[model samples]
Target: MAARVDVKLAELGISLPRPMQPIANYVPYVVTGNLVVVSGQVPAIDGKIAVTGKVSWSVSVDQGKEAARLCFINVLVHLKAACGGDLDRVRRVVRLGGFIASPSEFTQQALVMNGASDLAVAVFGEAGRHARTTIGVPSLPADAAVEVEGMFEIE
Candidate 1:
């Protein structure tokens, strides 16, 4: 079956752009056996970071959440590409890692990360849920307020 990710995206009125090329020296994704590991995805849209700076100081929590959502969308794009656009090839979402550029005192990492987690479940049903880590970071590439990475098990 083809990936339903695109359909869900269309339901949201979103169209995932082609996965962006890696910046710096790292590859964007790697497949090991049945597992596909996607590199950290910034909140970039159309090759540009949509928002920058630390949350609370320069960006709001809501904005960070939006960024997290975008990151997940990008992840799905890569997943679809890796599996030939067949989401049914996915067996499980093994894990997700999220980094939020925020003040050291901020304690809402879990909430911010949920933005992506919820979206995953929305698209893949129960298979979308996974082990996750949300951490507050001092900074990130392009000074993006949020970045998310994903891992999936393919059938």
Candidate 2:
């Protein structure tokens, strides 16, 4: 039998990417009590960053959105590990923090972040509604266009 969330992922045509090992010393996720804090995830597919450069500068808004969604998919990969490989253990998506590589003049970080937020709702329904903070940063690790970190409440 598949986990309920696993079925949902299949229905959404989302195959959770293979887990990536941390490049630095920090762990990918920390589970303390009922909360799982996922580390920042870059838009890497098959271990290679899919998008790079600054939004509204070298990267277009639509591309940035795709990068954001990819980052969230990586976040989900880690979150599943934190939940013992069962996404159905998730109770709610408490929060998500999005960091976008952008110039100081760029002001559409929120719109770019919608990529991740929309997918969250699609996967988790109402439980995915979360508080979010979107920031336009000068750069992100590996020059990735987007980075996403999340806090999830799990059963």
Question: What are the Cα lDDT values of the candidates?
Answer: 0.86, 0.95
In Å, residue 103's CA in model 2 sits off its true spot by 0.5
Off by over 4 Å in 1: 1-3
lDDT at position 149, candidate 2: 96
lDDT for each residue of candidate 1 in 1-155, tens digit (9 for 90 to 100): 43466577678787878787888899888889999999999888888888799988888888888889999988877887788778778888989999999998999888888889988888878998899999999999878889999999997
Instruction: For model 1, state the Cα shift of residue 58 in Å.
Output: 1.1
Model 2 ranges off by over 4 Å: none
Question: Candidate 2 at residue 50, lDDT?
Answer: 92
lDDT of 1: 0.86
